[model samples]
Target: MPERKLTPNEVSYSAAISACEKVGRWQLALKLLDTMPQISIVPNAVSFNAAISACEKGGQWEMALSLLRQMPHVKISPNTITYSAAISACEKGGQWQLAFSLLNLMPEMTISQNAVSYNAAISACEKGGQWQLALSLLSNMLGIGLSLDGTTSGAALSACEQVSAWQPALALLDNMLSSQLLPNGLHAGSAASSLRKALGDSAAYELLDKLRELWEDNSNSNSNNNYNNYNNNSNNNKQPWEDSNNNNKQPEVRLWEAGQPVDQQLAVPPEALAAVFDVLSDVPGVIAIFKPSGVTTEEAVNELSQQLARQRHVSESVDLHIVSRLDHPTSGVLPLALGAVGSTAANWLEAQFAGRLVRKEYVCLCEGPSLGLTGCQGNVSTPLHTVELDGGRASRTEVSPIGRQAFTGYEVLAGYMPPLSSEPLLPSHDGEPGATGHADEQRPEGPELMLLRVRPLTGRTHQIRVHLASIGRPLVGDLTYGAKEASVLSSCPRLFLHARRIELRDLAGKPFVAEAELPHELEEVLAQLQQVAETSPEDGHQS
Candidate 1:
């Protein structure tokens, strides 16, 4: 417009600033906002709001607040939109206190608070790891007559999930139902994850079934009222296990009866347990299965034992002795002894793990390009202490001097760098800003990942996870020890640690080895990384 001899006014400047905000060009937006006043075009609240929103999208919280403060100096009173954008900027920056202060200040400034403002504050608390404060803000919103929405409830649920507050997470879901807000897959998934971590796989499965039923009832009601034809059509046809956003269904396991043909057993449809437990090795007294992620090790063993008894028509209770165990999210070789608990075979198998005579190798994808890791091979000797959380509902391992001794050997396989980009490759949240219903759902930009072959010499709770994180390289989806990196790479479905190989003596004292190939999902992630690497320049680096 200036080149055409027409001086751009505040309206034109605001529009241009908004255009920059959409593309996350916060610096350019601020520059344009500054230039407007130089040309005798007095900036208005609209101009400042656009610039503030631009900063928010760009994750420049300080600059956003600076713009907000300058608005008052320029005789432009900050309005609801202005404060909301500023608060959201703080949320993106992980500055929960500042976000809450801004929200509280709004009412004193005569700027009425809205759902957007409250959502931003609540999300900030979630990002800041303040679940209690997030819940408090959520309660305050309801007390002040602000009706709950998916965004509000999702943020609160995410906070509870992060802390493994299953009770509160379920309460929040119930609240969403009472408020007539249909919980999405993300909401249900977060609550299920919390239950899984705090209770067990059975509890999570039960919750999913309950939520699915509620969703179906709500969908039927809406369909009868002609509320949303598209939603009813699209959702009604989906399977009970399928999530709307994520279509991957949880695979099931089918246990075979004794003397059953291998081919026939494979042909049987999955039942008994809702996971893929591929039998790797079955000896006289030792049985090893590839335990898929999302099912606890104990749950897998118990279910398998019960299935075996039923198949054999045994009236007595069947108990499988667990020789080795893995975390709920860790997938791979899990060995169980078929002999009685105190039998010679069971004692021998347990002795191998207890005495560190067995060899266990794991492959994991961890946050990297780490300078500290240095070579192709390295070892970490750290004392790890497990601390109970939420009154023993959960626990986490940390490196401490007074903790139990733990050692891990690691060999770097490959490093995958993300494509170079000035802007984030993934959205900060799923649907909209501050609408991430689960902490594990948000996908912020992350550094390169290092695929490593790790061997834990000393068996301790979270040994490998804590050791790697102690050296500043945390696993991709380990929220307990590496919450920061896990949040950055939230696209990871679960913890990227897999038991690739296990070696121990069998019943006859012969050397036995069981190996499990990497799961298809993990392979897909690696394939995408390889594709990106081949397409990008060798020197291309994340900015």
Candidate 2:
């Protein structure tokens, strides 16, 4: 195959032309256009149309328009596609004047009128907000006996939304059905969104019923028996590896061979140039000639329905997910880990955590050197916040103090609150001699700190944080509720929060527990605070 060039035939030019178009190389396309006639390559309408399309894609709108002006001199008449691409170029360039003018003049120029041509014109008008003009053109399209396609209908509906024309939107929806075009969710969304934005929340709320009804009806009629039969392949209703052909060994490609419009391009767009791009890579060219055998329009629609059902199945399956997201942190946020064990596992996990049947421990700063709030931040009681789930239910969170909380019965590891702490001095009091002396200062008003092996009876939101704050003692740095001198107590830089541990009953009701360490940040802060408490008697407030 010594590069058998076909003497610069239209086919060769078309291939080179399309390649240039796909890559957005307008200069190369123009250069190739110059070379076509050199090798006796007569420039047909297809050749020029492709070059124009290429130019449009390259953002050479003026150049593409120039090419159109040059169409008549080359003894080539602009076809529907030629004008369509030209109009599309004008639309893309935001040259609405040119776009509208060309569309109006198409008939006089004796160019054809097709769905693509109509779609481009309507979209331009929509983009330009020429609602009245666009509507007039759409009505005129019907007057000319060209049935509106989904593209036309969808654009009209979109324009309706852009212009805040809900009445026209409903009318358009009715027109879509009357014209036998199926209105999809995008169409419905446009109308609904417009209504919602125009009307208040209450009015928006009412549309939900109509939306629901339309969606149900649409879904029911959307699929054929073929899809239903395929779905029945499993009683489980889960088909990960499904499709008539599991093999993607070969793909089909489509090439526009001649004056004929590419069939693949004419029909619904294929995901790839080939029937399959990935798995079916080896397959030959696409189904180019698409009279579709004996497949009538209705049958084509049915097949389309089948394809859509499969795609929807894929879309729906992909959409199915288990996610554990935290709504807000301060109120308490659950780590995304919460969703991993869901449904039955989630329910079981919730039960054991709520029961708090499992024992726990925390190394807290007890205002004692032995207590060593170092690395072991002061412990405070906190509860797993109850989360309102879909059905208005609660789920428990598993947490513990800084370290491990194990064993059924709790035991204190170490630490104590310094006794004889200074109490708040009363302003009116006549001070006693010992009370006034530095050696005999009153004890501090707040409760002393100590290490404790406490067990929780229940899990509630902010249970630990709130409970500790409530008991005349809060974690050294917790300020969410209220901690004594918390605003200035920068010792523990963190809120003393930790997932700490989780406890739950296994399938057999056998208890299981997992603990996470106090992250280094919390540990470091605790170490410094404990050291301060040890050095000064007043540090622990020895009165």
Candidate 3:
């Protein structure tokens, strides 16, 4: 456009800066912002906002503040976005005091404080280990009726977790549920971690169980409401599939039988569909079950749908909608919507996942040489992209710069050393076969293993596995990502990954939480590791 004699205006320059902001090109974004004024185009708030946001993403807190100061010099007033970006930059740069100062300055400048600004400030406090300050800001935000989102709650919970402030964290969780904000795994996990730190393991587990029960009750109540609403709507709309002649008859399965011959049938036997899933929770419009390893999520859904149809005495299977899915080798809590495709309950459940309002937590056994030094807890923010394999028939995710954002946080629950190598055991003094020396004497030197509590914020495919692998700590039995380790741990049954918990909202906007205990196989593996640790010289305990 410039070559064609059409000079770029403020809009064009701002657009270029915004594009740079998305990819964290702070240098280029700042250069563009500087060039705008040189070209006689006055930089507006939009132009500065993009540049500051780019600086924020690049962790350039000083540069972001510099841009904010430059705004007033250019005769452009800062807005909420401008201040929020600057505060967020400070949060990322671990400058909690600067973040608070920016937040406090917002109101003085006649700008209304929004959730984003408060969230950034709270997160900065969280990073700074100032739980009291974080809670104070959160209380102020709530007192003023400002929007409280997951980020706001998460930051507060994290702050509390850092200080082992279990009571306040629990209160915040209760407040979240009362306010009808859906709490996901991260929120619950943070609170639980705090509780465990302050009280004990039993107390934390008890709290989670109670929470699940409370959410289940809420879901049951809302499921009834949804069923009533659906029935009322159906009666009013008079769906075409409904039989006018017989009100009690089931809806016709005309769509399924349209192209098939009368004699030729799509048969699915009742016994074949007799899936004996361990029902975790069975409310009106939702069903949470334990999906075992080796079964694909689709197969579990199909079998459950058929079983539900049989129970309802319908000739065809019900259209059970899948809200979330786990890999074929993963086993845990699987929640499914128990209604037609576009029904209120199904749509609500689908929306929770699509909007990322649902929270999922997993447990896995990860193996790596540096597992001991990887710390007791950390987060992986590596972006991931799915790539095709075997001529596009299969796919897997790998860390890539051009990929979409993905985050996975992990806490080490326990650690264990691998079994001794294949060296022959010395003969016993009593003439018995057992003569391996002390565990400390015979311990093998190889990759360390850990039991990890994992929470994946963004639900990318194989996110936990891929992210862990990217950090050199892959799941022990993950054949795809830990193929080299799989040969060594041949006794492992399958991928040692399980979706342990899930949190969601029903059609009535009530929160629903559920948990699936570890399968016997995985539990046995952990038990063996515990036994090994107990005998080892340096008991495998996380710092």
Candidate 4:
């Protein structure tokens, strides 16, 4: 009898692809995936995700994205695993922006983002030197109640390391310990290692000291004392990925050590619990507080709830509902509904934001005072879109035809040229030495900056930052959009945009407004600019 052959079904093809994936044979796996349809075997999500995993392990990012896009064309919907694998591939290939877009797409596609997907996207950002974005994503994770694991937490540390953000790196390690996540040897070492590269030996040792103090504090006080003992042993401090038998594997490489330019400078911020926010408004069933910069809206809410509980002399937990969220760098009027979960007060406030009945007002300081944007007030009705740029760090917001239509009305409040610093605050447009020319001259005329009162008719991720950047006047400290380097504005360590006011009608049909005053740091910056304007050569020195 002749040898009998069976046609390869989906199961057979999937198994073949899995084998290829296990062995890092990404090309073979892709070819098998392609051959399946040719052989009349329709590929499902399982087979496609397996191929993506193979590509991820083999660092085939472009192929992974292609496979992911092809799934929808074939009438196959991608699940969480599909997106996670594709994101992992992008991370391996240093395509952090692409990975972020895919993660964002999951929510739009009605698939809930899981810890795995977020972890992969964060790892990609870490690899791409988008430490700010990575930290922001980590903050978002807690808002959604996703559990942070070794992989996710370690990626955040790596991102801080990439930028030499020593303070945030240490803060993150301390956070992990407080969260009971146990800072592993790998993450701690990476933070220290990156600190050494960024700020020199003194900074790295300083970080090590902070880590030791944090470990000791947790050891002396935490109820789970056993978890604190891991840091005591010297020889057993192995990285999470290392094993006793696999001593031959070189540790993951650091990009900074490999001569890649640092992405951005990050200042060490005070702990969230230590921040004190001013009370803006105390309306019925609602209180508006001035949310400080450098903390997520969720963290602000948590801290505010604790403070309120303390003032009430209550030990039990209280549910404080956040009506709307501001970005970590954005300090603004954050409204909190003090009520039980699903209370009518919470629902009403939430409904206002959902229905776009709430009005928000922002004050921003931006570059390019000479630009015509400061000439008058008008509405910027351009539709905005978020996209992954190949030559850019993280994702960028752009004007696109298919993007969500947005409206922002703005009028220039004031404009001035601050005294030039001894060193340039913004990075030079050309990479050559002192392209800005402000760095070398005596009393050089600094870049013109303008303040604007902005009203966003539509809420979008990075709406104000992107809109302003699109009009050729990016915010002073907004490194992500169009702000030059952090050194450009040495006085302002944060994005010079503030959500000064918010207005809404209560559920009872009563109109109300909540507002936050300018932060002290912003006030100081403006004050200095005012002094410079008064003493400028362009203006007769006026008292």
- Clash number for every model? 0, 34, 0, 3
What are the lDDT figures for the candidates, one per model?
A: 0.70, 0.47, 0.70, 0.67
The residue pairs in collision within model 4 are 425-487, 425-488, 426-488
Sorting all predicted structures by lDDT, with the top scorer first, yields 3, 1, 4, 2
Model 1, poorest ten-residue lDDT window? 252-261
Point to the candidate with the largest TM-score: 3
- Residue runs of model 4 more than 4 Å from their true location after superposition: 1-45, 49-276, 313-315, 340-342, 369-375, 387-396, 421-447, 486-488, 530-543
Model 1: per-residue Cα lDDT over 1-543, one tens digit each: 868999789999999999988776788999999898788999999999999998887768899999998887889999999999999989877689999999999989999999999999999898777899999999999999999998988889878877788778777866665565655656766676666666665556555544433444443344332212222234344432335564634321111112211111111122433244677887655778889899998888877777766765787646677767899989999988766654434555654554345789999987733322213577777666675543345677767643554678888676666534312332221232111111121112345567889888778888888777766667888877764533445667788999999987665445779999999988877786632132123344432
Better of 3 and 4 by TM-score: 3
The TM-score of predicted model 4 comes to 0.47
> Candidate 1: where are CA atoms >4 Å away?
217-221, 224-543
Q: Candidate 2: where are CA atoms >4 Å away?
A: 221-543
Can you write out model 4's per-residue Cα lDDT over 133-219, one digit (the tens) per residue?
999999998899987788888889878866667667766765666567655445666666555655454544443333333433443
lDDT of 1: 0.70
Clashes of 3: 0
**Model 1, C-alpha of 475: deviation from truth (Å):** 13
